[model samples]
Target: MAWRYRVGLVVAAVALLGAGAAQAYDVAPHRAVYRMALAKAASGSGIATAEGAMALEWGESCEGWTVEQRYRLKLGYTQGGESDVAVSFATYEAKDGSSYRFFIERARPGSMPENISGKAVRGPAGVRAEFEAPEPVKLDLPKDVLFPTQHSLAILGAAEAGQKFLSGMVFDGNEVEEATEITAVIGKQIPAPTEGEELLRRPSWPVRLAFFGPDNAPGGLPDYEMGIRLYDNGIVTEMKLDYGDFVVDATLDKLEKLPKPGC
Candidate 1:
């Protein structure tokens, strides 16, 4: 799920240089609330029911973009048990994608909270990262790796260009070990639905993102896959997370614009 959270975006409308389109593609800063529930579950999956809520606050700063995400999920098991899971995640990514800091905490019944905090810097040599929590360790990544925001921008650019496929390795602070390989399938552009709020009444695309683990071979089954109705303005109105045995659906329940930084 680390890769899932990394898709979160922040900051005001930053221009996409070399995106090769006349239309302005700006990412809006806002707080989005989503209601989550089980869309489907395979038999013998043991998952009886699932429901939850997620709140994501994305804002901008003078030097970078910031995000705070809270997720709470209640799962009912067929064997007569329930588990409540909560996750708190925060991140700060430099405007140039040169630096990133992240903190994540996850808690569940009868288990101690697990916390991961770290920072990474991308330079000409490559990406060097240091973790200060749960343990002390260092890592280095390939120079060609893309950060989270950079990955988002690349997807937007590809969609605008009518490119149906894009793939890359993305490093978000969530997976301290290594970057995750991502393959994106961009679908045809869709006109905005007339039933949503004003902010959602914009053109969008059906984008499917497949996340593969480091050891997965080419064309192997992805560790996780998500489908999103991604708008041109960088807003996601709907999402479906597929976990093989079960699928969770997220629908946008509320949206609030965040004030942009003076810088």
Candidate 2:
């Protein structure tokens, strides 16, 4: 998986659940930690083992929402090789969903380190982005494009309304030139898990999100997919990351409620 995009998108789903929910969705500011391990591997997948950890903090501000995430993974191959990947991501989205700022740093074996930072705003014309690192560039996006936080709310909104499928374009600042098309499949709501934090006790749904790249053909396979037990208040109890050849499971290990903004 492209860890940069993977980590960024993961945060997009988990951190922004505060804006949408069933029956007057309440905002939740919290911190979470998850332990990741390989759940399965396809034949000849070349993946022998995988283990990782992810830490995320979601907080509310007077004017916007803030999220910080750190992720690390170590992969062992059948052929006796290993790869260690680490990524740190942060973003802020205006409460009104009109502006966003992001920064990401990633390191992986055999690849140049990546550093990305940018700010984007929505205007009558469309979404505009101005990058500040790895070469500055200005770009315009589709008028209908949604930022990460907005996209998450849209998904939760659909779930609350009993909709099963929704698709749209989203810009998470992982790419510089264009936004991605995401198709979400919302499963029927189920009772919350019997364990974990109180936040996890709320009703949630099984959501599968498929991300398609701009270069992908219409109706083609997605670049990657994520399965999450998404709570109404924007908490994820668990996650499954599917990369076609292998699947990784992320189990929530720690969750803590955060104080709401005084404003």
Backbone clashes, each candidate: 0, 1
- Kindly give the stretch of ten consecutive residues in candidate 2 with the minimal lDDT sum: 14-23
Model 1 has an lDDT value of 0.75
Residue by residue across 181-232, what tens digits does model 2's lDDT show?
8888999999767896677778889999888878879878898889988887
TM per prediction: 0.89, 0.91
Error of 2 at 170 (Å): 0.5
> Tens digit of lDDT per residue, candidate 1, span 228-258?
8887766787888787788889899999988
Stretches of candidate 1 exceeding 4 Å from the true structure: 1-24, 193-196
lDDT of 2: 0.80
**How does residue 235 of candidate 1 score in lDDT?**
74
Q: Give the Cα error of residue 59 in candidate 2, in Å.
A: 1.0
Candidate 1, after superposition: displacement of residue 103 in Å? 0.6
Identify the candidate with maximal TM-score.
2
